[model samples]
Target: MLGFIESVFLVLTITEFILGNLVNGFIVSINGGHWFKSKKISLSDFIITSLALFRIFLLWIIFIDNLIIVFSYHTHDSGIMMQLIDIFWTFTSHFNIWLISCLSVFYCLKIASFSHPSFLWLKWRASRVVVGMLWGALLFSCVCTMSLMNEFKIYSALTRSEDSPNMTEYSRLKRQEYNLMHVLGNLWKIPSLTVSLIAYFLLLLSLGKHRQQMQQYSIGSRDQSTEAHKRAMRIIFSFLLFFLLYFLSFLILASSRFLPETKIARLIGVVITMSYLVGDSLILIFCNNKLKQTFVAMLPCECGYPQPASKGPFAS
Candidate 1:
């Protein structure tokens, strides 16, 4: 039953990934949603959409692993192919966490400039620098994980070595290397996740100060500022929930000595992962009245396009 739910969330997450990308893609430069002469993609736009792209790629890799596990049932006997796939997964997970950390920091600086829009000029240049570094680090981690790809054991009553019956001496040693890399892979997650969360809180505090200054303005301006702030706040919490649940999975694994391991760890992991999709989607669903009303107004025509005029409190 728990696996069934995670499966559903996996589907839902991919759906979000696709739709969000389409939104980021089709969003026109002009406010009226005309395709004739759309706005050019600015650096900020590229950076923001890049974050969604990162999430989509991350989820897709994890989805592959989920499929492999379900189909193979953890037999753990695939050769080089499976080993390489595991390396990809490890690197993707690490890359996703760090990329999102940079994103959180980017948002902090972005929001910090509510008063001085010129401040974002530096971010435009910084985006390229950050993206390059992120790719380099991800590649480095991928190479490191490959070092552990060949390490595995086939323990049996008659088996004398850590190597399997069919595994060669080189394969056996490679397996040892792979095992070591697994520990190192997980070790990186601890710092990556910690950095991501720390950025979240610092960004939140920066936003709080920004909002306070906006409070002195007219109701109309203040209301717009409030809406944007709330949206950012929701995003911060949504990511926090995603990472928090993931961290708890580690604790669940550690508790295996005193508690049943597989059932509880897996069941809870499913719950945590699903909650991210459900909760984050709910934030978008509840907040985006324009998206909802647009569909309603275009019921007999092309549905899901933005309405000609939206009365959403947050609509610009």
Candidate 2:
């Protein structure tokens, strides 16, 4: 039987899974529908759509892995299944994070008022640049997946040699192997995190510079360009906040292996990670004008309830 904490974690994971899928699905459908009719999509929309699509798969992979872990006692051949799950999880997660980083880069190039020759040159070729980044991300994921599979093979071989004479030594070695695998699993995320942080700081710097220029030109009135900078800043800031939380939760969950009592900490980590999946999508929907409009229109109107006015800083 599952413990109380485990039961709660299960429920929360399911709730977030469902909510994350809905918001991500909404993003895909809206952008997809527009593309189908128009036969084209903006580079930013294309990236967002692809990111949402990968996130849907990533969420399913995560949910399935969680279920397997929770019920491993009742299951046979779980190790092989887990190995397969890890492969898919790694690929999907890599795509998700790298795409987000690409989005940040896209935002910086498109919106940031930079006059540097290199920045202007990249902005002019933004679509090709993002495509190249996506391909590079795919190549990197392939390498990481191959490395993980190799590790899994070695670990499986160790497990299969359980009849060895040095049982104590085997146990210690197994523990060490497990720890090494854990670290290897998480190490791939660091590059993506670094890229995202760099893009975020660049956006921040651009926003600051843009604001300074606006202050000098304006006569106590905000202009459209100023509002654009603010909106972009908000979106990127939210992404940075959620991405950092997600990364931190992974670290906490990884540390749970060394702690004597880890159920609570592990559960907390899982919850926060799931929150990032759901919360980031919600922020994107609310902050993007088309998404917000479509989301509000989809809600059923009540006779007496006041509909939210569309006039806000978020409005495009």
Candidate 3:
């Protein structure tokens, strides 16, 4: 029997799962089809496709996790399975964050006007730089996964150990260790978040400099470079907005573990976390020119009216 909040959470999760897959699948199919036909993909499309694919997997993992929680499927014997799921979740989540940071870096290097020799060097080899970042992120995620697995092993061993005469003390110590490990696992996200913030600030600086130059030269406000900078900023800003929300949801979920009575907070966290995928994908679609064009083309028309071509929702 589902309680009211559990029922609502289930409904929201299902809705988000369906919506996320639809949007993310659209991204993959469009980009993948283009790649298949042309045998090449733009670096932006490649990153977008990869991010959408991982997000699809992340959605599935979150959906299953929510189901487990709502249904109380967790049991003593299910520990190993739950741990495996957690590892997969961690890997995908880490990649998602790092890939977003990589995208920010890519946009900054490609669009920003930076005069530094290092910036010029990176801009010339942007593809290689982005690819290297992806590989580095992969290696780092693998290390985190391994660390989590080791922690799980330690926790499992502790769980199986015989109870000491001071049972209460031993139980308290185990609980503390579990909470500590959870916090440490989440702390791994900070480095990627820092990278994203730095990239964002650099882009903002470049935008400001470009605007000042335009003003000094009396250049038109609707020039290509200005539009490019604005578009990139919109995309990055949307990413940051949803990423922060997702982070907040994680905090709420973590707090719910400590305050077991706050079932509503846990449910809300799960809903918000799942919503991030759908929200971010929709933002990408509207912000990216190719994606927005393709999405508009896919819509049905009525009354014998031709659909207007999309130049991106964020276009000036």
User: By lDDT, who's the top model here?
Assistant: 3
lDDT for model 1, on a 0 to 1 scale? 0.50
Query: Which candidate model has the greater lDDT, 1 or 2?
Result: 2
Residue-level lDDT tens digits of model 1 in 1-316: 3477556655654565455444433222222243234554433334333443454454455445445444553553355555555566556556655655655554555444434445456445556655665676577567656645334332221134444466577556654554444444456566666755755675566567766666655334445544555565566567667767655653453342245554444435434543443344334333445433543564587545544342322342
The candidate scoring highest on TM-score is 3
Clashes of 3: 0
Instruction: For residues 81-155, write the lDDT of model 3, one tens digit per residue.
Output: 678777898899889989999988888888888889999999999889999999999998888888886677667
Misplaced by over 4 Å in model 1 are: 1-64, 67-71, 113-133, 136-160, 163-184, 211-223, 249-316
Worst 10 residues of 2 by lDDT: 302-311
Query: In candidate 1, how many Å is residue 111 off?
Result: 1.1
Model 2 scores a C-alpha lDDT of: 0.77
What TM-score do all the candidates reach, one by one? 0.57, 0.88, 0.91
Cand. 1 TM to true fold: 0.57
CA lDDT of every candidate: 0.50, 0.77, 0.82
* CA lDDT, candidate 1, residue 228: 56
lDDT of 2 by residue, 205-259 (tens): 8777877776787744366655666777778788888988988887777677677
